[model samples]
Target: MSRRTASRALIAVALSVSLAACGSDDGADSPDSSPSAAATEVTTDLSEKPEVPASDDPAPDELVIDDVVVGDGAEAVTGSTADVKYVGAFYESGEEFDSSWSGGADETIPVPLGAGRVIPGFEQGIEGMKVGGRRMITIPSDLGYGPEGSPPVIPGDATLVFVMDLVEVTP
Candidate 1:
């Protein structure tokens, strides 16, 4: 084919592709597209309870964890990854809500230090700990579970105490 004819054919093909893309109704699989109006509902089994303002102090009757000793190490950034074994509890009644050691699990998970993956307090407190170290972070409700607290086991406005074991450094 002549150069002008070949160029025209290529241009026509490009225009066709553009038009087809613009006409597509499927937004789910499109990279730049948003979820369609028929988007599925987002739900979870565990629901958080509304929190109340808690005392700034760790409750007087809170149970004591003898083994954990708080420390200071690296200032953890949002995306920083750390090797940590953690046990969480309500700061009020001192109930064990969730833990990495639950069901006698010994393996430590690599926690991505960020906002969503972890409680805001745990994420903020664990920063600045060196490897082979531990920190007993006592987070007040505002810094912890917040207004929408993890309920039943973790009561609203409950202070949280975490014994964070920093096993290694992945950064």
Candidate 2:
């Protein structure tokens, strides 16, 4: 199977295990237990910078992309340039490392997809997203800065999390 397909399979298995662990044996009435529900519950407001919460579950070995809000605008593809506002943090600790919104909510940066400008996980995760959409991207270390890491802000072999808001897509 292709890498993407394999990665997706791994994600599904990991999420299934995680959900099973969160379930109660007595089957008591519980809150919405889906991964999307938990992720969406953190922040769904489009106007504000997304808030990425700390995860109790172990980091996945593959990429996980969860859309918090679906947009109704132009789509982003390999050749498209995406103007996005984002907040980046460590997956394990939810400690912020970088953000396009650091300057201001209106401050966004353009990312050239498939251009090798950004990390592999980030570029791949943002693909197929539409303008005005918000997504949570969980990236394994291999797809991020790797074993050496970016340093200062990112640690060695860190699993990164990014809450991204796609503002516009330039074809």
Candidate 3:
């Protein structure tokens, strides 16, 4: 499939998974409180337009998840849909590939958490977030586009970084 087609397919899968998961709110109330402490320890800035990190290259096996702004609202569970604004960039070149912020305020996307619709690292990175939270996720190539990559925009074996603002969670 073409890159754009694959992306659309992924989004469709995510939406379907979100709808199915939302039908049964089994674990919505049992929010894990451990991440709250970690959120307090993080001091990263979460600008609407975030600056790219200056690192040359991160380890290919690493999946770094840092909370930029911790929210006091509901915790993001595994089978939930999160309304978010995000910017994705290549870790090596610091070039942005996609962004919800670029399309203005109404462009926030609903991402299915813990589903296999998105990259593996992205799914894991968003796990413990709360509504109104901001997070910075640095994903290795293995967990991102992998060996084949997205092409044109994303190079093969490229690591990716995302600055995400979780606006709300629908369980």
Candidate 4:
């Protein structure tokens, strides 16, 4: 498998483990369920390559979702899979850590939306995205990797930023 695929798998496993440990299968208690005022204050621009602003710490609560491009195509919904190109970075430094784009245009990944297979913020972020749409998602630690973090690359209690382009949706 490619690095991007591996990363996605790892994220899925991590999220699954976390959720199982908590004995919650529905993700109802997730922080991303309700958007806070701070979550709506995020700004995003997708005209060119995305640039995330640096922050020292994660948002106290809530996940931020900002739309960059609204595509005129089929919307991605729960239980559906979305083919996407994405770049991930640390919110504190805006330093890129992973990107499907790095592997070229053909590297788009198919990810399940709202299946608890990914981080809560990511699952919620793509809820209304259409094929060809683009978005920037800011995830607080609680809604991301949480206090344990993803190890060497992602720090404990760190915030994450992801810029995603929804290429297609398969229901």
Sorted by TM-score (best first), the order is 2, 3, 4, 1
Q: How does each model score on TM-score?
A: 0.52, 0.78, 0.69, 0.68
Cα lDDT, model 4, residue 16: 89
**Best-to-worst ranking by lDDT:** 2, 4, 3, 1
Segments of candidate 2 deviating more than 4 angstroms: 1-37
Q: Candidate 2, residue 62: CA error in Å?
A: 0.5
Better of 1 and 3 by lDDT: 3
- Model 3 segments more than 4 A misplaced: 1-47
Candidate with top TM-score is 2
Q: What TM-score does structure 4 among the candidates reach?
A: 0.68
46-102, model 2: which lDDT tens digit per residue? 887777898889889988888787778998889999999999988877888899987
Q: Report the C-alpha lDDT of model 4 over 4-40, residue by residue, as the tens digit.
A: 9999999999998998777635355322333334323
What are the clashing pairs of model 3?
Answer: none
The Cα error of candidate 2 at residue 58, in Å, is: 0.9
Off by over 4 Å in 4: 1-49, 56-60
Q: What's the lDDT for all of these models?
A: 0.54, 0.84, 0.73, 0.74
Query: Candidate 1's residue-wise lDDT over 1-171, tens digit each?
Result: 999999999999999999987765634322222321111111111121112122245353322222233234563455778877766655544456667765343557777877467666666655555664454556677777666777656667666776567766665
Worst 10-residue lDDT window, candidate 4: 30-39
lDDT of 3 by residue, 103-137 (tens): 88557788788778888988777777877787877
